[model samples]
Target: MNFSSKLLENAVAEFARLPGVGQKTALRLVLHLLNQNKQEVEQFSHAITKLRNEIQFCTRCHNISDTSICEICSSHKRDASVICVVEDTRDVMAIENTSQFNGLYHVLGGLISPMDGIGPSDLQVDSLVERLKDGEVREVIFALSATMEGDTTIFYLHKKLKHFNINISTIARGIAFGGELEYVDEITLGRSIVTRVPYENSLTK
Candidate 1:
């Protein structure tokens, strides 16, 4: 952890602060960047600066964007009436990569975790309720992860949206297509069987 130069030490410290990055990894990254041409390093620094300074969040879904409204929200081809409720913009990106969902998204900003001091009020819950009250979205699909926090958030949202006319749904949680039944967890295998779809319905998709 001892760097010959204070500048290198500072850079390594900053890099180490990033998630999943250890001190050794940070030191390696800093060394790698140090070996790069001055112009390339300047460009790298400028790009980071630009991302922090110029990034905007979508007014509708709270997704990261370069404008007030994200491209997906503004797209005419997407189904605005069906909103996919997710934990954050990363979920949006993951779903978008699938090319399977053609619906709009509602980023909750973060999940409800009382232990972490994050409550429903800390998220975009009010805005989502308002969106539902506006009577535009007909179907709301919950696409949260299968964790305790994710489940808690979904339950809270379900209660808040129970009276709404929108059709409530959740992304199917089960074993992967190629996964073996023996290797799958008991809860997942049980849920998969309980939510098993008709063979004909599965074939169509």
Candidate 2:
């Protein structure tokens, strides 16, 4: 197969770099983009560029935001005393879609995966501990995945935060094993929050 166009190859290569996109899918996407009108292509490129340039991480919750603090963190309607800790901004969006949690959030950025070399220090765990120093927070709800890495991170956090009297809880197992909060149904996610268990007693009988 003789490759003719460098531009098309570059576009396919770029698309392939995205997570879960294979060479075939990347080629298909590039062809689809090529079929679109010039104005549509320009708009797509502009949107991608704008997302990279305008969006930033919220200094407080570590969620993607246009400002230092996200709108959720600045909202007076949310309960500042309770923080729902999630693995990523996607999880935060998933929980927000349920509208069941009225508290603030803390995005850990990622989980502790030893095989992937992602340790507790690699995440925003220290920031969470610092946030608790104010004593305004009464609860930290762990909404991480149910995988082994997730369990390990939660246990580490529990031990680190044991000195604080605040309640530490984990979302109920309504979410199946290996289930990601981003993919769980809204009703199941809401139910999980309603039936969350105390983290301290999770390992106990």
Candidate 3:
């Protein structure tokens, strides 16, 4: 089979490196981009470069932002006493789109998965504990996934914050098993927030 230029192959390989994008899709995308005008391609390249160079994670919430703190953390209209803990910035965006939660958020960056070599210490858990130390927070809502790794992270966080006076809760099981927050619809996400329940240990009773 006749092969394309090395430049086209390189672009396809780079696109394939993105999450969930396979080689075929990557090749198709590269071909589409190659068909575009030079000016358009230049604009696309510039935009992607700017995204990497200009964006930064918020120091407070760990969400991707242009500044040190994300807009949600810096906004005065949000409820400072309530904090929702999410697995990543995507979950934060999902919850924000629902418009059901008005509180701030703490992004763990990932769940506790021993198989993946990601533990509590690897996440932003210590920052969460530090934030709770002030005693200003009234409630903490966990918006993590329903997977075992997510459950383990939740329990670890609960144990760590048990001594605190704040109420700890988890979003309702409206999210289906193995469902990712990024794929859940806004209605289900909003309902989950509205029907959140307190975390409790049945064995302790």
TM-score against truth, every candidate: 0.96, 0.82, 0.82
- Cα TM-score of candidate 1: 0.96
**Candidate 3 on 43-149: residue-level lDDT in tens?**
99999999998889999889988989889999999999999999998999899998889999999999999999998889999999999999899999999997899
Q: Against the true structure, candidate 1 has what lDDT?
A: 0.93
> What C-alpha lDDT do the candidate models reach, one value each?
0.93, 0.91, 0.90
Model 1 lDDT per residue over 97-174, tens place: 999999999999999998899999999988889888889889999999999899999999999999999899999898
In model 3, the Cα lDDT at residue 168 comes to 97
Among residues 3 or more apart in sequence or in different chains, the pairs in candidate 2 whose N, CA or C atoms overlap within 3 Å are none
Going through the candidates in order, what is the number of backbone clashes in each?
Answer: 0, 0, 0
Overall local distance difference test of candidate 3: 0.90
